[model samples]
Every structure is written in structure tokens, then in C-alpha cells.
Target: MKRPTPADACEVSTMGKMEKVPTGIPGFDEAIGGGFTPGTVVLVAGNPGSGKTTFAAKFVYEGAKRFGEPGVYISLHEPREEFYMYMKDLGMDFRELEERRVFKYIELLPPLGTESIDVLADKLVKAVVSLNAKRVVIDSITPFIRELGEAKARTLIRNVLKTISKGLGAVTLLIAELPYGAQVIGLGIEEFMVDAVVVLYQRRGKAWTIPVRYLEIRKMRGRPVEQVVYQFVIGPPEGFTVLNPVPLEVRANVDYRELLKTYISELDEVLGGGLYRGSVTLLQGHVGTGKTLLSLIIAAENAMRGKKVLYISFEEPTEQLQQTLETLSYPVDKLRPYLQILFVDPKSITPSAIVSKFVRRDTLPDLVIFDGISSIRRVIGRELYVHTIRDLCKILKAYGITTIFTTDEKPGKDPAVSAIADNIIWLRFRKVKRGLVRTLMVLKNKLRWSDPIEYLLYFSDRKLHLRKLEV
Candidate 1:
């Protein structure tokens, strides 16, 4: 297992002749110009439980498992067995790599003086040489800097780590412990010494109620840092995954004149026969105005027509939605084959992540219904919410997927959201002689002229009924 030379580690790029070694983290390589340049030292700094260790381990494990590039992990804090067990839980079987003689884990306990730093460096070099490792991670250099002072630690990094990176042609990921809520990354000097710096944050902010994990690339040598911050999650099966922003491009090469009928004859007539194949429709109304029911009806209608429909409810659970369908007399068992229902908790995921998961798919659905999208706006804030929805609609439109978004009507709402939709249907309740009656109005329609007329909407015999109301 001879270590790859600098040339072997290099991957040619269009921007220049620089060589890159992919980190093998999903959605992360693209943010860093394909991957890290060969023989570059990357400093990963983060507070405890911010996934610094997990990120480092994944880098090493991925190199060994996917790239056939051997790796060595030297831990100054974590024990070997515990680290292996934890990594195994995350789907990284380091033991198998070790058995293949391509991976090694060396743990050095603390209580070390200045001399021990040299011994640690020697051990790392020896391990890399023995296994011909191309990836190395030091799970953390914080203790050394704390114990030996910044001056000695700087000397060690410059002489040892950089040498191993350049001389051995191995990419080095040096982990640094950042105190909670601290602005500085790992004693502040580590960033200047490394070729790249990635900071992980676990903190509560305006974006989410719970502590959201974020990955920020403060610096990356020779790479365009177009996006500085990204939401990340560390979970099983995949240790570290970054939620890259979804690319918004209208690439649907479909006929915009084509229409997909909603199966509601009167509503379709009001909507100029049907919705355009690649158009976005907004179903805005106050609560209890049958927004969910109407969206479900559209979804069921499409599903019954043998069209693939995806219904994502941010407010209702899958079981609750199924119950609603049963109560509405919709054939749940029959519609199950074509209609895919998913319940997402707005608090559990970021807006970008949600859009990325559903929109960036290989085979998109024919129609998508987002029920209770107001919850999403509340969770991700206004600006991001608008951007996410705009990008999402663009992606769906490009796939020729008819999308219906249901949001609660509220005062002071940003018009940018409604402006993005190709068509807008405003649902409200009007006081009639017989209590309150539900009304539907087509405020805007891009495909055809929509008369400013309100329709009385109601359900009878499990069927939706609509009638023109004289103004």
C-alpha cells in the first residue's frame, strides 16, 4: 500500500492545473472546488459535539474505503476502541480497513510535555510511512497548543504536519477544539497555518428553535468559496453530510401550453381548463378554509389518473392525512400506488435541506402538493423561505411537475412568495345568510385571463362543488 505521490493524489481541474482529492462527503466536495487540493492541510475547528471528530473520521474512512487511499488517525484525546465503535455505528467499518492493512488508528493519552510533541509527530510519520497512508487526521491539536503554548505548537505544525502533508503527499485534517460561542477558531493561530479552514457550529439562532448545526468554510486555498455557510447534520449511515443549496435552473424542455387537469370540472374551467404542465399554483387561505382538503383532492385526482403525485405535509402526520382522506371518502387504498405522502416537521429540518431532499431527485413526480407551507416560512424566516420556495418551484417547473403550495393567509405577508407562483387561488370564508360559506377566487393566472369572480365552494356527498356567485 504505497502512498500516492503528489501527482497521484492530484486531480486536474478546469479552473487551473491544480490537483484535488475529494473528501468523499456528500454535497461537500462541490463546495470546495471538487475537493481539497492534494497535500493541503485543512484545519477543522468546532465546539464539542459539533461533529469535528465525526467529520475528520469520515474523511479518513472515506479515503480508505472509497478511494483505496490508506489513512492514519492519531487521536490525542479519544481512545482507540471507543472511536472505532462509534465510527462503526456511523457505517464506517475501520476494522475492515485495518485488516486490509490500509488503515491505522494510534491513540496517545495526555499528560505530555514539549518533548512528547516530537514523539507524537515521529509516530505519525512512521505510521504514514508504514501503511503508505494518503490521508491523516489528528483529532485534535488543541491539547498540544494548550499545554506547550502557542509558540511551540506553531513550530510543531509548521515543521511536522505541513511536512507530512507535502512530503508524504497525504492530505492532513487537523481537528481543533473551539469553545462554545467563541468567535476564534482553535487559539486563532491554527487558521493561518493551514491551507483550508472549516468551522462547525452548533448553536441556536433565528433560523431554527433547536440548535442547528452549520458548516462554514472560512478559507480554502485556490477554491472559489461561493457559499460560505451550509447547514449540516451528523447521523447514522452517513457520519457527516452537508445540505448544499439546491441549484435553481429552468431546464424543462417541455411545452408550456400543455395542461394537467385537476379533475374538478368547475375549478378546471375557472383555471382555464387546467394548470400548465410546468406551472406553480398558490392555494392561500386562512385556517379551516379547506386548503388541505382541496390540495388533497387535487393530489388524489392526479393519482387516480395514473399520474405520480407527491404530497408533503408540514403540519399533518401521514396517519392523520390518511385519516382525513378516509373521512373525505377518497379511496386511500387505491390512491396509495400513485400518491406518495410525506410528513415533515418544519422544526426538524432546514428549508434548504427540505428542498434539496425532495426537489433534487432523479425522477420527479408529475404533481407536488405542499400542505401547510406557512409552518416552513415560520421556521426558516422570510428571506430564506422566499429563496427556498423560489428555487424549489423552479426545479419542479423544470421537471414539468405541476406544484401546488398551500399557505395560511396572513397580513404583512411578503408578496415575493405569491409573485413566484404562476397562478394564485385565494380561499376565504364569507358571511352568507346561512352562516359562513367558503369562497375561492382566482386572483392571478398566467396562462389565461381569470375574471374577478368569487365562487361558492362546498363539499357534498364526498364531492367538491363550486358555483359562481353574482357580485
Candidate 2:
């Protein structure tokens, strides 16, 4: 029996009952639910240097090259040569498409638009009709609004939506810029008139803070799109591709304990059969608490067992991580072949980017560690950290790999990373009546119940031991 489609699923897409356009961007299509629906106008908005023009133009180029759909890019800012040249740097091969007649360009500035473009909406509409173009990209609609005010921009966008989408059956993308701190809602008209509205935003700071690229769909005329913070990075030739996101299934039942096991066996045993294989484990504590040391033990042990291990350090350099491991007398020299120590300080190449580097499911490592969690707290915040960790646990669990992470918990504020872990182990300084000693505690356990809520943990001259202590 044919099942009825849910009412909410209607605006999620308009590509027929089961049709989907495969533009082939790495992860972009999936975030917006799927590719653009036929007869849909998608607005791509972003700040300057946010790769706005580069991303939109490239999408149209892909439609021409991959799907064999003829495309046209209308530039409101630069002339044809400049527009084509600008994208060339980002690796868009528009010249070849133009030669093949599969692509064309039209610049609508005063010089190219002889008559006023605002009053000549038909001229722009005619170009798309004559080219028989199925894909159209207007470089930017911000300046084009110069000739037309808010009311006129609204009417013009409405007309363009009707002509290209309904008349020409074209999948058009309108580009616009967004000012910071201000909620620019696609001229408010484009959002209502278009089938899909995609917003591109730029954020600056450290590498982690250096926002790669983010896309949000405010409206999808009638189609489904996932609402997730996607790492949208457009590499040289490919243009815009989202990082491989964690599959939906992994988010719910990730086993964090099993991942803890791949790091340290004793810790695993204490953790009761290791972290839940698919759950995220947050290892956070105070300063000088040996978070980094704990990670080394997990990495070296996993490598000794012939399982691959990856240790990423944001605060500590690679050389520093290795030097610190030597103090633990870890068998780092033995499993050097199987262990991978990646030193990444840049913010843009985030935890999610690690997923892009580990696609080889055929031989995925058995254990992964994000050593010293506190240091990375600011790089990828608590909220995003949860999402990334949730997705990470699912992917690692699907491959049966274990992961261990460490974070710093301030004195009073609860640790931000604790909730996501399957098992949470903490290390902090505790002063006993006799002396001040570093303590380790089983704050939370998603794996199995553990006895002795708190324990006296001490490490001296390469030896680590724990003793039962009063909480």
C-alpha cells in the first residue's frame, strides 16, 4: 500500500515525489536536505571575502558540467571578463563551458545594461529565456538594489521568481551580502518569493574561530533540509563542499565507554568494560591534572595492540606531545608505525575536518583521542563540541573504534564537555589532611556503575596509581 507523505515533509523539497538533483558538492547538498528543486530560486547571502560569488558561480558550473544543464551567471558587480576571471582563481573552468555553449555570462551594470536594469527586469528575464538556461546565478543583488528601493527590490525579485522559475523552469540562485550583528532576512521578499533560501556567513578569529563556511535554510518552498552547523569549506577546484557529517543514527546511541577503552585498558576496566562503544567520553579536570598524560597512555597502548591511534594537539606542539609521553615510559617507540600524531593549531580545520581525513572505512583505526579537552574548549565551543562529539562517536562506533578526550573544568562552573561523554573521568588537585595530592574521580559513567566515587590518584617518576579515598 502506498503511504501518505507527512504534511511537514512537503516544504522540505519540491523535486517531485522522489527526484533529487545531484550537484556533487562534497557535503552541501545533504545540509540543505537535498539539491535544489526544479523551478526553485535559492538565495546565497554572505559577507565580502566569504566566498559568496565563488560558491554560487561554481554551483552553476557544476550543473553544466556534471548534469549537462545549460547555465548562466549574471553579474551585478563585475563585467563578464572580471567575473569569469575572479572565479578562475577559485578554479572554476567557465572558459571551457562557454566554448561548449553549455555556459554563458551577462553583466548587468550600467555599461552592460544600457537602459536602467531596475526598469529593465524584462531584459534580465529575456537573457535567461533566450539562453534556455536551467541554472542562473546573479553575482549579487545588494548593489542591484541601488537602482531600486526596498519596495522595487521586492517587486523585481517577485517578477524574477515568476519568470525564471515558473516560465523558464530555471533553478536560479540570487546572491546577497549580510551585515554583521544585523539579522538581514534576504530582503524579506526573496525569502517569501523563492523556493529555497540559503544564508552564507563569515566569522573571524583563530583557526577554530575562523569560520570555514556555514549554510542555513530559512525557507525551502516545499522540501526537507537538515538543520545542522555544517563545516562548509570550498577547496580549490571543487568550490563549496560541507564536511562529512555524523549520520543521524549515531547521535542517539553512541557508546562512549568502548571508545575510552581503546585509550587505556586499566582505565577501561575501571570504566566497566570501556566506554559505551558509541558514546562520547569527556575527560576534564583542573590544571596540572595530567590530562595530556592520560591521552598518551591511551594512544601508546592502543598502538601497542596494533590498533591505529590518532592524537591531535591544539595547545601543545607535536614535539612537546612526544616529549611529555616519554615521561610516562610509554612504548611510543614500539608502535610508531601505527600511531598518528597530528598537530593542528588552525581553527578552520576543526574536529569535523578530522572526519574528512578519515574516510577509509576499509581500515579505520581502532582508537582515536582528542588529547587534553580543556585546551580545545575555546577552539570548538561546548555546544558545537557536543554536536561534533556526538557525530564522532557514531562514526567511530560504526567502525568499532574507541576515542578518549580531555577537557579543563573551571573551579566552579561545571565542565562543558561532560554531558556528551559516555564515561567522564576527572583529575584535579585535592589536599588531604597529610598533603596535597592530585585526585581522579569517576564523576559520571555512561558505561557501567563504578564504586568509590572519588580516589586518590598520584603519578611520580613514571608511575601512576590510585587509592580509595573519602569523597
Candidate 3:
């Protein structure tokens, strides 16, 4: 679809408001002013695998399942059995809804002639009337538009789709397919005929490998669309979920003098007592500089003190991390209750998805150890990486959660993160006559002046120890 312009904004303001029907997609209804306006034809257009079918199906399923609204799904292509199975995998069991008599699925074979358009429209109207459906989906209108040409297609939409919407008072989602690399939504005529238009896009990142999905509300007749674009994901349990990156407005009334101790005495001493409450800390270092271990020690120690700690690891799995804790003589069993380890694959998930999940949580953790943020940076690219980190830090600090983000980058490399950080700890390896020795230094401290001296770091008897480094 085309980007909305000034003229489009003016058009939206003049339209009168109507009753809204929620689509049941998470984080989506709120984006579109509580949901789709009733008695309107909405065009859901996208390239193949961009989730047009999923979006339409969800609109129908949710109406039937949650709102007790009867719905009808008319498919010009995909068979009934295949559609049922595919939707079932996404946790939408159309069969069950069909059995309840609240849902109807109709499949029509194509090579649809000019005469067949009337017949198809008649069947759709009959289905809606029979079921007294409140929602309808035509998946899709592309074949009809291509076969019948623009003039005939326009007549079909205006005569049938709009008639069903206005007369029957059902919200209709007309699915349309845009060929790969094509920008226009369904030959251009369908867009004007529809009341609203939503475009789904599967865009590649900077590496051009991972696919990032986005949903853009190109046109909404009655409602004022504040944010046009949103990142979304489609999976099981819930069909489609929008990941809203809008930072929450939270005021954390915290005393800078109050400290959250890590219980590592030497490290605490170096930290000017302990980490300031509601402050963000960045631990930067090269690979194998003991960044992970140090962050884990802080997480585990705080958890042992009955504080909830969320350890988000992008690189390491839970079992591997538990083993490391055991190797360090940490009580893994004892730490399990208070320490919640979440392992996320950077490739499969988008940064917005991760942040959205955190935003939905009922209770925020006392401490969050985000291990290996560099992996996320690599997958999402630099621009998105910076944006996601900035938003995440803002949310965490707003909740007054002391967060520690570990990355495999040297100090001053990522000024964006460093600027957001309240404290920066640089860890590195010093190669001397005795071989490589691990060392730690406080690069920046917002609450107090950082000590200039570097310190030797080592582990003994399952505890980390630190001392002044002497040449």
C-alpha cells in the first residue's frame, strides 16, 4: 500500500464514527482505536507468506470464539481440510467452532467466470444470512480481480462486499494478494472500494537473512491512526500478536543513595558500596573475559537474598548456564526458586517481540541480567538494536529494576548504550609474564566518581575475588 499523505489525513477526520468490533489479535485492537468499525469492508493485503490468510482467519476465529459472534470464511483457493489443519496448528480449531454452528467455512473452485462472480456473491450473502454472522472473510479477492479485470472486480466489491457489509451489518475482511516486490494493493481499484486497508510486510534485516514482520494500517476511515506501523509475530497458542515498542510512562521514585548489593564484597567496594537502585549497568568485555560469570554471580547472589532475578541469555541455554553455576560452586537448586532463567534465540525472535513480552509481565523483577545483547545487535542490525536497547532500559529503569546488560564489545565502541548506562564496567584480559590474567575496571559511574585503578579478578573456592593490580 502507499504511504498515507496529508490528503488522507483530512479524509479520515471527516468520517463519522460507528460501533467497533475487536479483531481479537493481541496489541492490535488498541492500535486501531478499539477495533474495526462495524459495517465496513477492510482489505488485508500482503505478499504470500506475509500472513494475510492468518490475519483474516484470526479475525474470524476471534469473533466466533470470544465475542460469541457468528462468522463466515469464504475461500476461493485453499481447500477446507488444509485450511482447518493449518489454522489448527496456530491454535485456531475451526472445526470446533464449526461444530458449535457459530462458524462457517466455504471453498469455491476458481477459473471463476464473469457469471460465477454473481453466483459466488449470492452464496456469501446466503451464508451470512443463514448464520446471522457478524464477521466475514473472503480469502481472497485477488483471483476475481485478475480474472474479471478492474471494472468487473470493482462492481463485484461495491455490489456484493459493500452490500453485505452495510445491509447485513457485518465487518468484512477481504484478503488481497500483492505480488512480490509490487507496491500497489490489489490492482489499485480495490483500495478505493474498501473502507480500510491493512498491509502486512515480511522485510529482511541488514543481513538480508532474517525476516521481520510488520503490520501497517494504511487507511482507517473513521478512526485516527496514531501509529501506522507495528511489528508483529504469528505463532501457536495465539495466532497474531503485535509487538508495540511504545515506551511506558513510569515514574520511579527511588533514592540514589539506596544501594542494591551484589554481595561480592570486593566488587561492591569497587562499585562505591553497591549498584544504585533503579540504575542501569553495562558490562563490556571481549569473549572469555569472565563477563558472563560476573553477571551471573550478581544475579545469583541477589536471588539468594530472596530478590527476584530474571536472567535473559541469548547465547547460552538454561542447562549450560546451570552447569556453569554448579562449576562455580553456586547452589543451583537453591537459586532455582529465585533465579528465573530465560533463554531466547536472537534469530527466531525480533527485538520488539522481546521488549513487548517484558512489557506485558504483571510484575517486574528486582534485577534483570540480559546476557549477550551483542547477539541481538547482530541479528536486528545497529539502528534497531540501539532503539530496542534504549526502550528496554527506559522501561526497566522506570520500574526501578536494577538491570545489568552484558556485551562482548570494548568500552567506547557502543556510545549509544554507554550513554544510556548509569555505570559502565570494562572487563579484559592482561597478558603478563605469568600468562593472561583477568582484570576489571569501572569505566563510568553516574552516582560517584569511578576509581581509576584496575583490579585483578580470579575465582577461588567457588567465590570471586578481586585485588589491586600492581605492575
- Candidate maximizing TM-score: 3
Residue 178: error of model 2 in Å?
Answer: 4.8
Clashing residue pairs in candidate 1 are 11-20
Candidate 2 local lDDT, 76-117, one digit each (tens): 677788777867777787998999988888866543332455
lDDT of 3: 0.84
Question: What does the lDDT read for residue 147 in candidate 3?
Answer: 90
Q: How many clashes (backbone atoms < 3 Å, residues ≥3 apart in a chain or on different chains) does model 2 have?
A: 33
TM-score of each: 0.86, 0.67, 0.86
Compute the lDDT of residue 251 as modeled in candidate 1: 62
Between prediction 2 and prediction 3, which has the larger lDDT? 3
Instruction: Assess each prediction's global lDDT (C-alpha) against the native.
Output: 0.82, 0.66, 0.84
TM-score of 2: 0.67
Error of 1 at 320 (Å): 1.0
Question: What C-alpha lDDT, on a 0 to 100 scale, does residue 464 get in candidate 2?
Answer: 62
lDDT of 1 by residue, 1-471 (tens): 111111122243545677778888866876786788778999999888889999999889888888889999999888888998999998899999999999999988873788877788889989999999999998888888888878887887898889878998999998988887788875678889889999898866675656678899989987668756888877666677777665545464334567888888899999888998878989989999989999998898889889999999999999999898888777899998899999988887766566666533645677899999899878777787888888787667656778899999552266898788888898898988778889998988976788969999987777897998644
lDDT score, candidate 2: 0.66
